[model samples]
Target: MTLIYALEIIGTFVFAISGLRLAAKKHMDLFGATVIAFVTAVGGGTTRDVLLGAYPVAWVQDTVYPVVILLAVPFTFIFRKYIVNLKRTFFIFDTIGIALFTISGMQKALSLGIHPGLAIVMGMVSAVVGGVIRDILCNEIPLIFRKEIYATACLAGAFAFFLLDYYTTLSENIIYLITTAIIIIIRVVSIKYDLSMPKMKG
Candidate 1:
């Protein structure tokens, strides 16, 4: 499979796990957990595609997307105990998933001749909308709206990808790697330092 395609599958699986992790915490049934996983896996990309007027959306275009989520959700649900114990691992997966999706989304928009500025917005949307939907469904505040550096990390990563693609003569593969690394680092560091955007006084 192409690198981008593989990234998409991996991102789907990781994001699905994140959603299922929350469902497990909420005592959701297997069916409900799987539903949340499915939504988390494809919600952002579906939104991005629809906004871009891309036909059939991504999951419909590639059966592998849904198939990966299908398999991943059950695996996650079955290993809830073990996975839940590894909070750091799950957070890493979440970081990597968002980073991958951000670059993939921007690449798609750029391929369609979209302007870099708007493509960056599309990238952020593709990265975070799933988590937003998942949180809303779980009756929790979405991460983007919270003090978490989630969406900002995505936006910064998208901008990095755009700059590297346009300014540097680096290969696309290298660009993708650097952009993803930047995002992962930003997210991990933010979490490590308890960094957050300022909020209004209560």
Candidate 2:
């Protein structure tokens, strides 16, 4: 498979795992967990596609997306014990997934001749909307709505991607790697140091 397609599949898998992990914590049944996993994997992409007027959406056009999520559900259940023992398993997976989704989504928009600014917004939406839906379903404040640096990281990555594509001589694949790394690093550092955007006083 192409690198972009592979990255998309990996993103879907990890996002699904993150959602399944939360569902498990909520004591959801297998069916409920699968539903959560499915939404977490495809919600953002679906939203992006619909907004862009890309009919059929992504997962609807590609069976691989659903298959990947199906695999992730069982994988999460099978390794629940090991995953629970890992420090910040959900955070790690979610961060990586967002980084991947941001670049992939931006690339899609760019390919469709979207304006760069809106492409960046699409990238952020693709990265965060799924998690937002997942959080709402889990009855928690979405990370993007919180003071955390979640959506900011995606926006930063998208901007970096646009600049690199415009001004640099780097290959497309290399740009993708750098953009993803930038998002992941920004997210990790922000979380590690308790950094966040300024909050408004009441």
Q: Cα lDDT for residue 91, model 2? A: 83
Candidate 1 positional error at 125, Å: 0.5
Model 2 misplaced regions, further than 4 Å: none
Residue lDDT tens for model 2, 1-202 = 8898899999999999988888888888999989999999999999999999988898998999999999987787789887745758778888999999999999999999999999999998898899889989999888688877989999999999999999999999999999999999999999999999988899
lDDT of 1 by residue, 69-177 (tens): 8898768768867776798888898999999999999999999999999999999889999999999999999978987788888899999998899899999988988
Per-model C-alpha lDDT, please? Answer: 0.90, 0.92
> Candidate 1: lDDT of 18?
93
* TM-score, every prediction: 0.95, 0.97
Query: Relative to the unseen true structure, what is the C-alpha lDDT of residue 194 in candidate 2, on a scale of 0 to 100?
Result: 95
Provide the lDDT at 29 for model 1.
92
User: So what's the TM-score on candidate 2?
Assistant: 0.97
